[model samples]
Every structure is written in structure tokens, then in C-alpha cells.
Target chain A: MIKTKKIHKEIETLITGAGTILISSHVDPDGDSLGSQLALRRYLVSLGKKVWIVNHGSIPSKYMFLPDIDRIVRIDNFKSEDRFDLAIILECPDPGRTGDVKHLIGANMPMINIDHHPDNSGYGKIAHLDSGASAVAEMLTEYFLEVGYKIDDPAATQLYTAIITDTGRFRFSSTTRKTMEVAGRLIELGADPRYISDNIYYSFSESTMRLIGKVFSKFELFDNGKICLMALDNDMMRLNDFNSADTEGMAEYTLFGRGVIVGGLLKEMGEGSTKISLRSRNSINVGEVAHRYGGGGHNNAAGFQIDLPLKAAQEKILKDLREIVNGTV
Target chain B: MIKTKKIHKEIETLITGAGTILISSHVDPDGDSLGSQLALRRYLVSLGKKVWIVNHGSIPSKYMFLPDIDRIVRIDNFKSEDRFDLAIILECPDPGRTGDVKHLIGANMPMINIDHHPDNSGYGKIAHLDSGASAVAEMLTEYFLEVGYKIDDPAATQLYTAIITDTGRFRFSSTTRKTMEVAGRLIELGADPRYISDNIYYSFSESTMRLIGKVFSKFELFDNGKICLMALDNDMMRLNDFNSADTEGMAEYTLFGRGVIVGGLLKEMGEGSTKISLRSRNSINVGEVAHRYGGGGHNNAAGFQIDLPLKAAQEKILKDLREIVNGTV
Candidate 1:
């Protein structure tokens, strides 16, 4: 466990003393969490420390253009004896989020938590957490600024990615002046916004496009046009070659129509199980409803998985959304 | 002919004086040319004037989304009694440019030349022209500001269309500080940048996706690695249900590799002629070469049509490009 002191001081000591620190994030990570984690790693390296970063999961092929991605450990290819003096975690709010790396980190190194998620429970010995921020990368960005580290390209890109994903590319309510400030800094640091945006939010793989076509072709608008949903059965997902990660931003499509206040994606993950992501563009608390389903997130966007048949889960979720939207329960 | 005296005043005077003004461009109009033409028409209407604009030939379907497209005139629609006080030409550098609507401009009216090509020969009586400007729309933007009319959503959208198309969404060398200033003004005028950008650049029809897939499958890089070409024969076009406008920006795909100095799209436009669009990202003067081949455009991007077999045209063009890149005669 990390030593008790100020989180900023402890992190600095660990990173400086370790000579080499390994930074990591949970599996199937997104821009915000991953960007926060990677930005920290790059910042430390810039200070002359050897930094090792590993993603417990595969990098989204869309983000393959990022710098230092090649250095991020994936297969490890090392004996368990190899050790890191410190492990810094960013964004992921839970200790169980170590994914496959938990087994790897169990025997060696003290872990530190640097997150900005309300759900975080001060899980590590050194927790630098703030839930008020829109993204954990913002916290790290503040840290970097405090330490007099300039916002460089790698740092900017990751920070930009973090902001974009957390703020739904600046369309969500959490987007604030600070969000714009971070984005502007990134742009000044030579982040190709159109390149980043087109790849991240516009362009898609052939299979992903096919899956989107299939899903939208069957989209249903309900509750007097206030709710919109696209459902994908297991068979359709398999046929279209859609990965679980591909559904990452699928909930966003429902917000296109004029009156789709509540939008969601319901995808069958396995037998008697479905994954649901909810998005509310305006005037709805999908988060409260998701909370009822054992999920919690911001008032506008949240998600949960269901261990029930597609139809049954769909019915229950709709009822919960109705209650929340109508202020009945 | 539009007298230079008439050009010295405000925009309203031009709209008022030109009772039945005609606007037209060369065949295969792009977003910049079309956006400027259409936006001027829409703005004139806001001033309570009735105006007529005709495209001498056909405006490719890619530009159909422009504001006043339906009002565009064609050769077949010309009337024997058709007369105008002024004819405003945009981007079209020369009269009788292929299917250009020279027939629609009665001999009695003076034409105003609004263009951004160096080859323009002071074609009209009242010319508001700057070849150094990236797009004709940039000129119209200045006109809009001088007219003292408050910029609105449609105006912003139109201006954005002009800037985006001209700059390759701000990546081309033509993107200047002036372009940025104009864009900033439009954004301040209530232009939803993201909304317009997503619509124009991101939203593609299903047919476009299919066509893109086919194009990728058939794309070819030249032996020298300095040239890339995609040729869509009429047969492939028909099979893919593609429109000529869908081929509008296809040539840009080739500027990707390490040394790809020139990229082109040569399409068999039916009958005996093949249409060609040439793009050189840096240094090469494709426009001068286009003029030599009976076409003219900017220094870096230009187009021409050849009445020859597809293979013959491709070979001739490639030979020329190889010579140009090698600085050989």
C-alpha cells in the first residue's frame, strides 16, 4: 500500500523513487479513464522516470493512432517476479477493476488511486479523488499544471480524449468552462481535432457500420416519442461481427430525433443476459432509473446489465424510465 | 453588364438593381461555389427581393443540399424571353464552360464575376474577385458583413459549408487566418458548428457507405508510391448505385501514404469522355496542368475531362504527374 501523506506528495515520491512505475486502467477502457491514466504515465516519463503502462484489455482500434500505445503492455511476457515499486490507477473507481492485472499486482507494489468518480470509496492508500470534476483527466491535468509540466501532444491527446468521452464530445450537461479550457489547451498542443473527432465519433469499421445499420433499421420510438431504443439480439451481433466494445457509444444515436428525451441501446450479451446503456438528452434522470437496476451514473447518462430475457428486461426498464420521467416513483 | 459603378455600393443595391439576376457556375459545382451562390440568393430573399439563379448545365447531386438549389436554372429551362439586370458568376472562371448557363444570361445584362481562381480573366463588368482567397464564399462573407445584415443560422450554415469544403475541413493549405476569422464570425452568428459539421461531413447515406466499400476494394497505388488513383468506370458506378456527386471528394483519399504527391479520380462519365479531378497536397501545380488539359482551378486542386478510353487517360495523366513530381519536362 502507498504511504500516508498528501496524495500529490506520495505519488511524486513513489514515481521518483521507483525509477520505474507501471500505470494501468481497467479492461475495455474508454477515453476518459484511459486518457487520464495514460496522460499521467507520459507526464512521469517526461520527468526522466521509466514508466510502464499496460491496458488489461485491447486498445480500441479507432484509438490505435495514439502515441506510446506500442509501449503499453498487453501480453506481459514476463515472469511474476518482475516488480514495480508503484502502480498508479486513474479513473477506474473500484479496486476490483484491476481486471486480469489484479492477479499480477497482488504480490508486488503499492497501488495509488487518482480518480474523479463519486463512486470511488477511497480504495487505495493514496487517493487523490474529486467527484466534482467532469473527468478524472481534468484532475490529472490540474496536477500536471501544478507540477509545472507543460501540456504536450501525448498529454493533450489523452486529456482531450478524456474530456470528449466524459462530456459526450461536449454535448452533455457535465461540459463546463473547465472542459472547454482543457480542450483548448489540447488543441494548442497540436491535437488534430478533426482527425481525432472523425476517427473517434464519425468513421467506423465495416462491420460496425453494418451493425449500426441493422440496429437503426429496427429502432423503435415509444412513450409518445420521448424514448428511443435500438435492440440487438445475440444472433444479429454475431452475424454483424459486433464486439461488446463496439456498443460503447451506441446509446448516442437515439438522441438524433427531435423528441427522443430518453435513448438507449439494448444488446443481448449472452443467454438470459442483456447489456443496456441509457442516455437522456434533456429533462430525464435515466441515472435514477439505472440505479434501480443496480447501475449508477450521471443524471443524464448511465448503464446497467440485465440477467434476464431481452423482452422482460426491456419491459422492466421501460417501466422504470416511465416512473422516473413521470415523477411517480 | 454590371457596371463597376454599381459595385461600389451596398449589397442591397445590387439585389435591388438586379431585378432578374441570374447565378450560375461551371458543371460539377462543389460546396464552395454552390454554397456561395445559394447563400447569396437566400440572403437576397431575406431583403424581400425575388431572384432567379440558374446553373448552365447540371449541379452535381453532392451539392443538392444547398439552400436555394431547387431555384437553380438549367439550359433546358431557359426561356426565349429570359432577361436579367445582372448575372453573378461564381467560381466559374470562363464563359461557355462546358454546360455553363451562358444561355440564361441575356445579352442586355452586365455579369458580375465573383471568383477565386488565378486564371479568371476579369470576365464580368463588376468583379468582386480575389484569387488569393480560398473560396468564393469568403468573398460573399465580406459582402454579408458590409451589407450590415445580422448573420443568422442559414447564413452561418452556408458560410461553414463554404469554409469546410474549401479547406478540406481545415486541413488544406488554403486555410488562412481570414478563413478562421470568417468562421469565427459565422459561429458568433448562431451557427451550430457541430450540427453543421456532423451533417455535412459525417452523415453519409447507406449508398455512400456501399460505394466507399467498393472504392476501397478497387483502390490502387502507383508503382512509384508517389501517386494514387481510383477510377470508377460507368459499369461500376451503375452497379454500386452511385451518383456522380458521390465521386466528388473521392480523389482526396489518395493523399495518405508517405510519399503520395499526387492523387486523382478518373471516372468514365458515359459516352466517350472520362472526368478527372486532380489533387496535390503540396508543391505541385495541378491547376496549371488542368488548364493545359482544358480545365482550370486552384494551384493544388483542379479537374479536367478527356474524351479518351479510361486506360489511355489514366496513363497520360500518370505520366504527366510523374514528370511533374520529378521536375522533368
Candidate 2:
């Protein structure tokens, strides 16, 4: 968000003058995405630079711990007089994978992709990708450190949120030795992991609870405990004022189920786009299925949005999951 | 909870020779206290020795993630055959400070008091209390390091929990450079912060959720925004079937009240003995008040138990809180 004065100069030269920076992320902004946005925004503000954290849409409610989080502007309403100097899309890949803002595909903004996803297509003017990093939040810590910015407590807090949230509190395989070092440094800078993880990851709204109950009630398991599936249609979502992001951990929770090798989420995104998220425990490949849909990720996790009806998409996912789970694919 | 075999050998010899290690703490059995106990228990078991981790009565449920958590023998249930080679109390001070287990107090076991409180009574064989240490957890890390025992992943995990939880995820004043170093060393040795914090801290149950709802619904604000209180009665708790530990942050949540100086929790512990917990935000010192009830902790955060009916305990605590908030005592 805050491209430092020197980085700003490079961006300016890249723009041939003053220009805009587009900010967007995964469909539902979790702690990592929002934390990354807030960190950059605060840094940019501190440097007296104009910056707007435009979204594909809104972030989840639990991350209200990020200071001044309410100020995030939506991508649709960002009234920019000039083209984006360097569009910075984080957490998510490119326009095709940008969910609702996928409409922004080929919108003519010079793109800068900064992400930790290994499957990135290098679809940016200047890309900085490190799949090795636990969280893009962790990446920002190194970025700030490299930029030699005197990041204080608030920046540390926001950045720490990014790392902790994205790395699943460092539970994911993405958590490497460097991740621990960065996280340790952040804690020393006053990240307060307990407060963030406690107040954000663990707590949920009553509405979220009801939605969780509804989803769990409808859970469908298969493949002799290898694959688990949960689906929610548009009607179910609307009744609870649920957005795509509120269904964040639904699929993953099933991974904790006894002997479940893979867990999958099939959410009806309405208008034929059904987003499917898949996770594996001990290497039942889901990325292959995701790649077939023009998406790819890690061996343990992958996701793709399909332009198919809810039931049809659900059937397709279940079939694929069944085959993979049974080793018959 | 696994102590190094080397430290285990040393402690076994100490126990055999010294015949007692005074097991006491500041007040409550937080992550630090329990982690230390659990890890030490595994070590003692390896040494083929029986160790007793006597608490006030019960440890809060938030920390039940440890093995043998329920096995923590309360001093009140002490049988005639129950004296130890050495009684090593980790987190409490005097016997009266031991919640419901106060009934187990006598002048029998020689004590080895290891703590970080400024007001320790020196009621032990070897008082290794350092007020500057961030936590007794941090102190134990130094102690473990001093005894020349290598902290493997599992051993490091216990120490890591002790340091992080007590320091409020490294946000509190107790966190020091050494704390981060200790964490770094632990990470280097394979201690996974995410696994421990998430497993130990984030894993909440259905009963906990229902209890949280009852808490928010029955909350109260008082002392001209200088205090917030929530009292859950037997019926409210019974209806929810929530454990006592599930309600830790309730009192501290009120510290966010802008004008509030302190916050308190007078939680009902069965029929008698109200579990009183307190937190101070800006200026008020709650430890002074807790001391009146034979409890002692930091100036900012401390707690005590009120051995009376829940309503009587609440009335007495409110009176005391008013005196502190109004500064008229």
C-alpha cells in the first residue's frame, strides 16, 4: 500500500508521472489480505502519499482488529482520474481468479502482482512472488525491513495478522524457517499474536454460527472417509446475509474429520460461477482438478471457480474428489 | 510436557535429597503454569517418579489441551499417602491464594518457589523469583537452559506456550529480547508456534460458544465507565454447560471502556468460593484489591477468590472496585 518514496519514484517513472495503485485480493478478504492492505495503506499515509485500498469486495468481520479497517474502499467505486500507476493485486492471483472483480479482466491497468501463491502465472508488469513465504503478511515484513522503513508497533500488528492468518497460525506447510524468524521479529515489534488470533480467528458472529450449523447439517461425506463435501446455495447464503467469505473455513474444518484425506467446499456463487475450494491432508491431489478448471495451487490445497450450475458443479466436484480419493482418477 | 532427561536426572536427585520443592504460583494456572507442569510431568514419568501438580482446585479449560491436564491432583483431594519427595508449585504464592485447594495448606513440604511476581513471600527452599523476568515461563526457559538440557521440539513446545501465553502473544510488557531469543531457539529446535497456540488457545468447544453468548447478554457497565462486570450464575452456566475456563477474557474485555481504569470478574465456582479476576488498563491497580482477598499478581493484572455466596462476593468486589476506581480508599 505504501510504496516508499524511492519505490514511489520507481512507480512514478514506471507511470511517466503520478498514477494510481490498484489494490485487491481473494474473494473474501481474510486477516492476511486485510492486514496486508492496512499495513500498506498506513505506511503510504505516513509518507504523505495518496493511496486507495480498493477491494474486489469486503473483508470478513472478524478482522476488525486491524486499525481503521472500515476505511477500505471498494474497487467498483474507486473514482480515479488517472490510470493506476502500478496496480497491486495481493493474496489472489490475476483477474481471472479475482472472483467478482474478474470483470476487471483486461481493464487496462499496468499490473503488479505480489503474492505467495506458487501457481501464479507471472501476469503482471512487475511481479514479486515468494511461495516459500508463509503469508503475504510475512513477505511484507521482509519488504518493510528491506525498504529500511522504521516500522513501528501498528505496522507490526497489521503485518503479524497477515502472517498468522494466512499461515493458519503457522500450521500450514508454507511455514518455513524464515517464516518463524519473521514472525519472531514481528512479535518483538509488538504483534500480539494472542490478541489477534483470539479476537479474530476464534470468535465469530451469531449469524456465522447459524450458517455454520446449517452447513454442517448439510455436509456430505464420501470415499470411505477420504473425501468430505459441503455445499451452500445462493438462497441459503442470502437468508443468513452470508457472503462467500463467511464460508471461509467450512471446507477446511472437515479436514479434521477422522481419516478424511481431502475436504472440499462447493459454494454457489450465483449466475453459474460456483467456487470450489479443496484441501488434502496426506497428498490426495486436488490441484490437478483445479488446473483442469484453469486454476492451480499446492499439493495440499487448491481452488477454482467454475461457470456451472450449483448442482452440476457440486456433482462434478464430488465425482472428481471421489476418483482422486479412491486413486481411480 | 517433557523435560529433558538430564534435567530430569538433576530434579530426581534434588527431590530424593531435598525431600520437597514448594509448588506455588501468583494465583491462576494460565498456559504458562499448566505447560510447565505438563512438560515436567512427562519428564518425571520418564524418571519413574511420581510428581504432584497441585493447583488451587482446577485449571481453566482453555489449557486442557495438555496431556494429564485432568490428572493435575488438587491439593484438597490429598490422601494420607499423598506427600511428595518435593512439592514444586509453579504459579501461586501462599497457600490461601490456592483457590478451592486452600484446604490442602499446612507447614509440611519444603518449597522451591520459582516465579516472576514482585511480591513473592519467599516461602520456599530455593526462591528463584525474578521480578524482571517476563513470566515464570520465561524464567523456566532460562532455568532449563541453565541446567544444560537440550530442548527438543516437544520440550520447546511447552516452554514456548509458557512464554507466549503469559506475555499475551508477545504483546505484554513481560516479553523481552530474551523471550524472542528463547522462541527463536525453540523454533530452530522444531517448536511449532502455530500448532501450540492454535491447539492450546484457539480450540474452543460448543459449550464455550453458548457460554460466550450468555456472557454478552448478561454484561454490565459501572463506575462511570471505569469498570465493566459480568456475573454468570449457576443456572446461566448450567443451561449453557460451559466450563469455567471458557470465560477468561470476559473481565479483561471491559478494559476497552475508554474511561475505565479497571475491570473485574466474580465468576461463581460452584456454591461458594467466587473466582475473582481483575485487569487494569491505564492507571488503577487491581492487585492491591485482590491482595485483600489473599491474592497477589501484577499491578495491572491480578486476581483472588471470594469464599462466599456469588451475590455476596459480587457485592464485596463491587465495593472494592468502586473504592479503587474512585480512589477514595
Stretches of candidate 2 off by over 4 Å are A1-23, A41-52, A59-72, A99-111, A167-180, A187-329, B1-28, B40-56, B59-88, B95-111, B122-126, B132-134, B167-181, B187-231, B236-289, B295-329
- Structural similarity to truth (TM-score) of each candidate: 0.62, 0.68
The lDDT per prediction is 0.69, 0.67
- Judge candidate 2 against the unseen true structure and give its global Cα lDDT, from 0 to 1: 0.67
Indicate the DockQ of the complex predicted as candidate 1: 0.06
Worst 10 residues of 2 chain A by lDDT: A11-20
> In model 1, how large is the Cα lDDT of residue A208?
60
| DockQ winner | 2
lDDT of 2 by residue, B128-162 (tens): 56777777766676656665555666667777777
Per TM-score, the best of the predicted structures is 2
Docking class of 2: incorrect
lDDT of 1 at A310: 83
